[model samples]
Target chain A: MESLQRIDLVGFGSLLAQLQAEGYTLIGPRLEAGTIDYGAIEGPDDLPIGWRDEQSPGRYRTLPRNDRAHFGFNATPASFKTRLHRSEETVLEVQRGEQGELRFVPVIPAVKKQAWIGARSCELAALAIQDRVLKDSADPDPRYAARREGVFIVAVHCGQAGGTCFCTSMNAGPKAEGGFDLALTEILDGPEHHFVVETGSDAGAALLERIPHSQPTAADLRRAADAIEHARATMGRHLDTDGLKTALYAQAQHPGWEEVADRCLACGNCTAACPTCFCSSYEDQVELDGANARRTRHWDSCFNADFTHLAGGPVRASTPARYRQWLTHKLASWHDQFGTSGCVGCGRCITWCPVGIDITAEASRIRQANGEPPK
Target chain B: MPPTGTERPRLAVWKFASCDGCQLTLLDCEDELLALTDRVEIAYFPEASSRMLDGPYDLSLVEGSITTAEEAERIQDVRRQSKQLITIGACASAGGIQALRNFADIESFKRTVYAQPDTIESLATSTPIASQVPVDFELRGCPINKSQLLYVLNQALFGQRPTLPTHSLCGECKRAGVTCVMVAGGTPCLGPVTQAGCGALCPRHNRGCYGCFGPSETANTQALSPHLERLGMDPPALVRIYRTFNAAAPQFQAESQAHERD
Candidate 1:
């Protein structure tokens, strides 16, 4: 069992400085262009304090809150994966010497030690899914592996659920279950605002000893638990994952697919916003002089007609086929590829999708069409 | 144009009837152009250089649409001289926004736009280069993306087959992780039927896709039309969306014709 400590709201800024002192760049959710995006932060002020986000299928708006709580929102569209696996990266560069000798240089990405603060429970679950896909496999990606090393995670428990969120149904969130260096539950009910911090690892415990904190009483611990419970209860959406894989596979040609296809623009927004979806394409660029060239890899989406392009033509040639491929792969075939489902129920797909297509609703409709009980 | 001392592949740029936006994309590759010049010789490009060289060129990048009788014959000669010909931008691939005249009376358009219609000497229809001669490849976009143009040039130089995505604009939107303007804001978007390129620009700015890159490989505009209808778009509005840039594309043209108000 790890130890728990109570840290006041002001002390959180010091913790960020201490992480910087230890040579880790702090990344957290900050307001940008009317939305909260994950970016670099220097102190507690950089966090989205006293700001709450209202999210729905196809809509997201931020509102001001009465209290000055640093993690007031549920989740940001930006995920932790952006830091580990960049959107675009140069993999190789080739140059020719004076003697006409060709020199090829592998562009190894410089690894940076990072500390991710204000991570939600679902976001942590998404990171774990990426770890299984990028690492702990037969062929681990060296770029992702290098960037993932020596990273610290500071998870914050959700006190309220967004309209699009369904983490509880996915059994992935509302509280930090594991996979975090430290977990914090903000207690804002009393006259003074404080956080009930719990260390999850030896490194976290050692860091906790360096910070100024007090022993949390029994009431403080209860309040932290109650906050998490309240969040889980208030979730606006639910998805029944019991036999979801088998159910989706059985309904490959279900009528529900065509209905969703009508609304689904095949825009690939859901997959791009999804934290676990890892598809990419390669580009070979030659310099103007034509003596040298560089190869780069960037994020790609399965929704693309060219994603499954062949010498003859595209494999999935219809909007329904493309939409079906994305949904089935995410909820069904992903289990076969990786030992887990691709979704962490973060609701980014719902919030970011231009047409406001809800994955949970679509899945439930498919389930009912396949003779399964209503969710 | 024959290869010079370095024996580098000779590249030529041709323009017919366009906004000159696509040709400017090549010049916009400032960093890559300096390096590309080292590998490939710019034999003839009126937009970038005054130096004109006689062909048979190794590779030809043709922009714009065939809107005149002279250009219709000239493109055939360009095809015969170039070893590999790749059409760039919507004008070269799908006849471009000027193809909107195909739906209206061309004679009236000429009389309205030009002071003397008899001296205009324009074809009734603006057609893509591929309609007249065989094109090796077609890069789709209102103005072709610089990175994609560089990739195609590199592939041609190395004698490797160039791979360009024929996917919908949805893929770019997803990869960018931009919130969907259509779904959330009820904005009518052509991203589902449009080809992937332009990096989902309109959606990033909280607007809908205008189908500037032409139709995707397997565009189901029929299905997407109903969704637009549900978003309160009528038949005339639907026709307007499909009849923008790349209006002469068969998929978009057929869909627009289907939704014609009259």
Candidate 2:
């Protein structure tokens, strides 16, 4: 068992500087245009202090929390995957040299030793899933492997849940379980703004050895546990994952797909915002000179008409077919391929989808349509 | 015209009855235009040069809709003269913003816009070049995206089809990391049905997309119009949004016509 330590709000600011001193660039949740997104942070001041976000299906708005507590929001539209697996990557540049020789220049992305602060457990779980798919797999992406190798994580135990959040259902969040270097459970008692911090790795322990901290009391520890417990108990959404993969596989002809197709704009927002959707497509762009070209890989969605393009035409021609492919692949087929379900229950797909096509509700609808009891 | 010893593919830019913005897009490719000229000769562009080489051009870029009877006949001659005719913008692909006149009385429009209605030898409806003649390809955008126009040109040189994704602009907005204005702020957007071009211009500026890039391959405006209505768009506003740039596009035209009836 790991011992917990208490650090005041002032000490939190110093912790960021200490991480910087330790040669890890700090990336934390910072407010951008009323949304909290991960960005470069110099100290605790860069964090979204005293502001919280209200998120529901198809809606998200930031509100004043009526208190001065940092890291108040939950469930950003994007996650660490956005930074790690970029939207567009240039694999290499093919140069036409003098004397008719062709030179291939590989684009090795510049990797930085980064200390990511204020990561939620759902985001961490997403990283782990992406690790299985992109890093540890037989065909590991060298780009993802390089970027993932030099990163420090600071996980935050969730005290509040977004209206679309169902991390409890996915067994992916509401508390920092294990996949973090250091975990912070923010305590906002009357006149006491402090964090109950726990070191998960030796790096975290060494960093804590330098920062000012005190042994936590039993109440502080309970407060940390109770905060996450409250979030878990009052989760805004829920899904019964038991027999889910089998049921989803059996639901190939479910009428729920037609129902979703009626409202699905096929805009590909849910897949693009989804942290686990790893589909990509490549296009060769020729320079105006026509002598030089670059093969660019960009994030593509299954919802795209061109995603399943074959010799004659698209394999999944209809919107219903595309929607079915995305949902089933995310839940059922991913388990077969990666030994785990693709969804981390971050609820970004629900909140960011322009039409609010909630996956949890859709899953239940599909199951219930086939005479499965509602969980 | 006398045949020159140089055998560069002859490129022609033709304008009909619309704004010269699409033709200007080619001009805006100033340095790129210079490089493109190296591969293809600018045989007949009255806007770029006074040189007016006639007939049997290798590639013809038509820039406007057929709003006049003369242009309606002239486009066929252009199609006959060119080996490959590519429609450049919303004007030539769809009938463009000027096609809004198609919904109203052409007589009234003539009387309103011009002092002498009889002198204006215009057709009753503004129509795309495709309605008059066969086009090899139609680039759907208001003033076509510079890179896409260049992409089409590069592909045409190699005798390959330009494989531009005919997906919605929502994908572009998402890939660009732009927040969904429709979802987040309840702003009515046409991005769900609009094609991916203009690099998601309107949404990145924090406003709703106006569907200037026109409809995607599978544009479901019937479904999206209702959601836009839920976001406080009245029937006329819904029709107006779709009927803007690509007003005559069959998909958007159908949706707007339906809303107009409602």
Candidate 3:
């Protein structure tokens, strides 16, 4: 029995218009190049209102739902990190001065205010993880921090889980939890003809004030509760997160890794698609005059044969070695450094991987071989 | 050559046969680059610095594998000049992707890959730096971790033992709370035997590991081999895993040899 406000359909449109008037670039989900991706939104019409995503290993397809369920999906292939941490950033530039004193300039990325529409619970949790690694630290990443602070989030509750989603097992989930400013559950069966909006932040409350809406009735709340309940019940994917780290670590000597390494080509497609993977390498470039030195940062993957070249040679010379570093760090050592699990259980790595390697199945094999319960 | 009364440690970066990814790690330290420069004199690094000073350097970071006779000779000379020489990537520490040539006929591989085989001058097999000259330390990875690189350099500069993880990448993954890609997702990964580095990136992304950090200390490859077979991996495929970048490493080499029986 909590007090809630409901904005009429017209009021919601005007609020979005008001946001545009305020010079905020409103971006939401749009069918672009055959994918339901987050992009520029003119209004609600631009969103994939009747479309839902079907995600699985080596597959991502959008299908029309029976009813217009806006937030019917668990997670999308696209994560917010792609825009925040760009693929390439020029770190250095070298130029000769008039006096011939070599000058090197390090370039920092320009920050922007991004308003994200239809973000999910798991993605919100993921953003928190990014904050801890990139911005929450004592030496925060200025560029990432600026973008993070300026961005606004409009989270949508998942009414259905994708085939590859295991957010529930990861303790991240169907329900829109904390971290999002505004949480909305789109219920198509309701006669109220609107979204159930819950304010989770001051920004959300302020935005609510601008939208024309009235207080929600008891029936609307009941319907919202039912939609969430239905989503929780019909989850398509499940994972055992109980003692997962220990089960895998205990079998550290297990030969299953070599088996996996056999099929893996060390292409690094998984790391590229992952929402949380954030390892990077830097580069230096000199201007044509060779007087100034510039440094740049780019995404680096451990699977590459040169990721760890030293004066004498590389330490991990085998693909098995590189693969081990990736898995072990993610499951075991990340806790030591970051104090939380690095994986949010998004299965993008499985779908986008050219070889279609399933992470959960491999972990289970190792666990079973070691006479351990599936965790 | 003696230092010009400078107390700061002189650092040198060298490459043999590589893709230049490993040497790039040093330059990749964007936030720490300026600070690190203040601590050490970058005496030599042809790829990054235009000023290539004569060696007799304090510390030298070498990347790539010894794939030629000339490189073999150069490493020995480098060993003579540097006080501490650390091999950074898989190529230097083991043999690297080029080491794949080890399994095949060296002459045939050269002929197949290069249009003009005579233009390519290579050793019979790609080999690690340790096989050529004495190495003070070896940093494990396909490309060494920047954090680890920074740590090793700091330790060398301060004359302290660099505290690097000798455990498998599986150990790091467990600590990170990353779901086991192999266990949770049934994605084949190589965390058990592979060295700890790369911060368990593949699994964080929900994919199995393709070992790039080489083998860990006390890697029980024999035990893991049978399990891989149980998981439906054939011996040839398993051998390919062992024969990757770190194929020449004793641990991986022996494992690959065991699979050759099939």
Model 1 agreement with the true structure over A175-258: per-residue lDDT tens digits: 989999988999988485899998988888888878888988888888988989989998978999999999999998888777
lDDT of 1 by residue, B48-85 (tens): 88899999999999999999999999999999999999
lDDT of 2 by residue, A269-293 (tens): 8999888988999988877675688
Residue-level lDDT tens digits of model 3 in A216-255: 7787788778877776776556666667778777877678
A best-first ranking of the candidates according to their TM-score comes to 2, 1, 3
Q: How do the residues B1-262 of candidate 3 rate in per-residue lDDT, one tens digit apiece?
A: 1122366679999998888998998889898786677677899999997999997999999998988989989999999999999999999988888887777799998788899999988888889999888898999888889888887887676676674655566545644445455533445566767877799988787776677888875466776666566556799989887777788888888989889987
Residue A188's C-alpha lDDT in candidate 2? 84
Q: Which stretches of candidate 1 lie over 4 Å from their true place?
A: A95-104, A288-290, A310-317, B1-8, B27-43, B46-53, B173-193, B199-208, B218-241, B255-262
- Best candidate (score: DockQ): 2
For candidate 1, give the docking quality class from DockQ. acceptable
Which is superior by TM-score, 1 or 2? 2
Model 1: lDDT equals 0.85
Lowest summed lDDT across 10 adjacent residues in model 2 chain A is found at A99-108
Q: What is the interface RMSD, in angstroms, for predicted model 2? A: 4.1
